[model samples]
Target: MQHLEDRFNKRFGYPWVFLNEEEFDESFKTAVKGQTSAPVSFGLIPRDHWFQPEWIDEERATQGRMEMKAANIIYADNVPYRNMCRFNSGFFFKHPLLQPYRYYWRVEPDIQYFCDVTDDPFDYLRDNKKTYGFTISFYEWEKTIPTLWATVKEFMNLHPEYIAAENAMNYLSDNGGETYNLCHFWSNFEIADMDFWRGEAYTKFFEFLDSKGGFYYERWGDAPVHSIAAALFIPKDELHFFRDIGYRHEPFQHCPRGEDWMRGRCSCNSYDTLDYAPQSCISRYEKMFH
Candidate 1:
């Protein structure tokens, strides 16, 4: 919290909303509150929102978990992680604590922030008419989402009117929605408009995905869910890449190159940056605008 505050939030003074399945103890709350003067509100996720819906087949979900565990997928056997994924994908924005906020910047613990944010990203989103912004782009593990693209395609067909005419479809599909190329913006570092997620198109899209029970039966992640929604519902110009923000989450780091690196006080080696790596979809993201 202190690292994030010192690097960015301290200057912006944006309020923080923390959500967990269990109640946050006083010590945890105090430690977080001590780092920033901005209002800090911690809320427990609602029971219904954080648990598997009654419609889900528990036996199927259990077998799926076992299969994924044998395959050594990350957090494969963790039920709480699946709940967390589902919550973030379709329910987080509706929480009472986040109701008043139109924009949110997602920050995770232990993540390094190398840049001093000179401008407010919320202001940028508002002024520039952007609905979603991200610092990283990558292809999802295909094994985890083998049926997700088919599900999304089915939804698109059923509700064609929800998709924007000038959307970023090419970024997601190469053969006209027959399959997914797995390109998705990493949602962990997102700064997005809540209104966009709450809108009719995204609401219906989430409903469609939820009905499939993939969050439990398959390890459907929130990153691909949000990325697919943004690409289909939002215009290309409204989707942004925050190249100036130097951030690292474990194996991948997005560091600015050359002059901006020096100006941002970034310590990451540009050569080690994953933005241009083979696994990254960033080059394709750039090509879309050209």
Candidate 2:
């Protein structure tokens, strides 16, 4: 919170809205409030929005967890993590406190902002007519989402009207939506227009994915879920790659290159940027432009 406030929010004065499954403690509220002069709001996620739906079979879900655990996938046995993924994928934009806002920059704890943000990102997104903005892109774990692509293809066949004419399908699949290549814009750092998600195409997409029970059965993450939807339902131009933002979340970091690095007085080493890594999908995302 302080990193964002010091680097960006202090300049734009955008309000911060934090949501959790339970009420935040007084100290937590005080600490966050002390970080910025901008308005701060805390929202408790509704029970239905944050838990495994009753229709999901616990036995089948447990078996799925066991299979993933045997394969040694990270967070394979963690139920809350799956719940959080589902919530972020479908419900975060619907929270009452967030309703008044059209644009949102989603921030997670322990993320580092290495540069000073001089421009208003929300205004930039609004003015440019961008729907979703992201700093990082990468491949997801195939072990976690075995059936997701098939399910998505099924959704596409059932509702062809929702698919955009000039979409980012190539970024998602090499064989024309026959399979997923696993590339996704890492969603932990997102600057986007919530109205896009609230729109009919995404609403139906999320509902279809949720009805499949993949969140509980196979750990379908919000990163890929949001990325796929944005790639399929909107023009590729609507997805903005925030290459200028210097940011880091643990193992992966996006360090602005050349002029942006010097201009922002960014603290991260440009040579260490994740865009250079073999696992990075940034090259594929960039291919859309050329």
Candidate 3:
């Protein structure tokens, strides 16, 4: 994170805030320059290791469980080395940034932040009623998603009272059950709604996924988890795709194309904005801005 931030600073001056999960505050504090507020070093990464240090034992255990699974896929297997992020996308709702306002921007470690972000992503979320948004979405191997659906099924059965739609299931399960298009919105970079995600249904979904060890064995990542949650839990029209991200994820990438007002990139699907326009929410924002 420090190294990536160092590179980012050469070209960008955006406020860089490091939320601590625990410890490392002194080291984290020393490494960062300019005005910054430190939050819980990114929140507890639920781990399962028994002999682990107790400095923040509970979090580590939880991380071992939830954080490791999703992170294991590309992180340990691919180049970036080391384990996948423990805090992962949990930092978004953790709300160190939104306590005063109502939204937040989330950046992952080691990702490149390019292009001038003149537009406010939070307002974009509000104008569209979008609970979640992402710059990229792509396919993941079928093998890795072994237990995620099973767990979700369990959650559905247990919470029979919760309302879910047939289309939402289509958004999640696809036409068949053998594979997940895995078109999860890349969470490495995001700006999103707080209330939409912190609600009972979304929280229950995470807990349900956690209980079934989806975050562990199947490597169910925040991308897929958030995608499924947003697709199944949140209304369809309210979910959005930010065409301006020009996002790149090594193995896969999405660049902005003819999204009119967006003039942004969207690799989630070749056809995503084909029906809509990049200006999508931007066009409406103009009316509101009017």
Scored by TM-score, the top model is 2
Cα-based lDDT at residue 75, candidate 3: 45
Show the lowest summed lDDT stretch of 10 residues, model 1.
Answer: 264-273
Best by lDDT: 2
lDDT tens digits by residue: candidate 3, 94-203: 44444544665676555553333456666678876767676665554445566666666666668755644432444444454344545455667666776756678877
Candidate 2 pairs with clashing backbones: none
Candidate lDDT (C-alpha), each = 0.90, 0.93, 0.50
Question: 100-217 in candidate 1: lDDT tens per residue?
Answer: 9999998887788887777788899999999999999999988777789999999999999988888998899888777899999988899999999999999999999999999999
lDDT of 2 by residue, 35-69 (tens): 89999899999999998899999999999999999
Residue 274 lDDT in candidate 3: 22
Better of 1 and 2 by TM-score: 2
Off by over 4 Å in 2: none
2 or 3, greater by lDDT: 2
